[model samples]
Target: MSYTYDYPRPAVSADVVVFDSSTDSILLIQRKKDPFAGSWALPGGFMEMDEAADATAIRELKEETGLVVAQVEQIGAYSAVDRDPRGRVVTVAFMAEASTSESIAAADDAADAKWFPVDDLPELAFDHSQIISDCFSKSDKG
Candidate 1:
């Protein structure tokens, strides 16, 4: 079965905020493409048709940062009118914890990958700063 929409729909994506509690740092990637190219961002991408948001988050984390996350929890959803330069994109953000020993490399749309202290991070792309703040809020409550 197939259906088509006459009106435009917001594209959905998932972002992962991988935090290393031991180092008090978070993994961020420098984007290789435009729409904030060269800027730091949480690892993520658009969701595939056969994938759920959680799976997208996990897959993107691995694809962009070469880091395998054991588990991810939904932190929040962000859908601002002009958040994405490409289109109206709504993103579901996920949070995970990793050890300081975990290895990471840049891949896919990532130009570079590294860990930044949570308190001292570079300017982030998209609405990632807000997403990270939301993730921190969620963690404080749990």
Candidate 2:
């Protein structure tokens, strides 16, 4: 059987560098799915067709955190070979920061979602560690 090459590769997604200036901490969710089950990672998910990158970011963020996204800034795009264990996936990383003093719990595929100090990060799944680092570097001086 011949496969259809007309379709573009499926895309993956992730939100990074979420921080609370009050606590100087970054937000992350404990993944409840495979490829890094039980590991803490940035809030994100797969991208759906017809939705803009930022739209996906807002949707995922709200779904995972239960907090309406107040602001979003596009950080960068990462498409490393083998970045995703499932298949070739491109991720658009977005930075979201807003004031929300309330404690957050997980919603979707995340077992739990919480904030951690940026400098004192836990071992994250995938190349998420790198994504977070790049985000920090950009705002490090600002």
Q: Identify the leading candidate in terms of lDDT.
A: 1
Clashes of 1: 0
* TM-score of decoy 2: 0.88
Q: What C-alpha root-mean-square deviation, in Å, does candidate 1 show against the real structure?
A: 1.5
**Residue by residue across 1-142, what tens digits does model 1's lDDT show?**
9999899889999999888887889999999999999999999999999999999999999999889987799998999998999999999999988875788999999999999989999999999999998888779622
- Span of ten consecutive residues with least summed lDDT in model 1: 133-142
* Candidate models: Cα lDDT each: 0.92, 0.81
The reply for model 2, stretches above 4 Å from the true place, is: 1-8
Residue pairs in candidate 2 whose N, alpha carbon or C atoms collide under 3 angstroms: none
The pairs that clash in candidate 1 are none
* Candidate 1 positional error at 113, Å: 0.5
TM-score of each: 0.95, 0.88
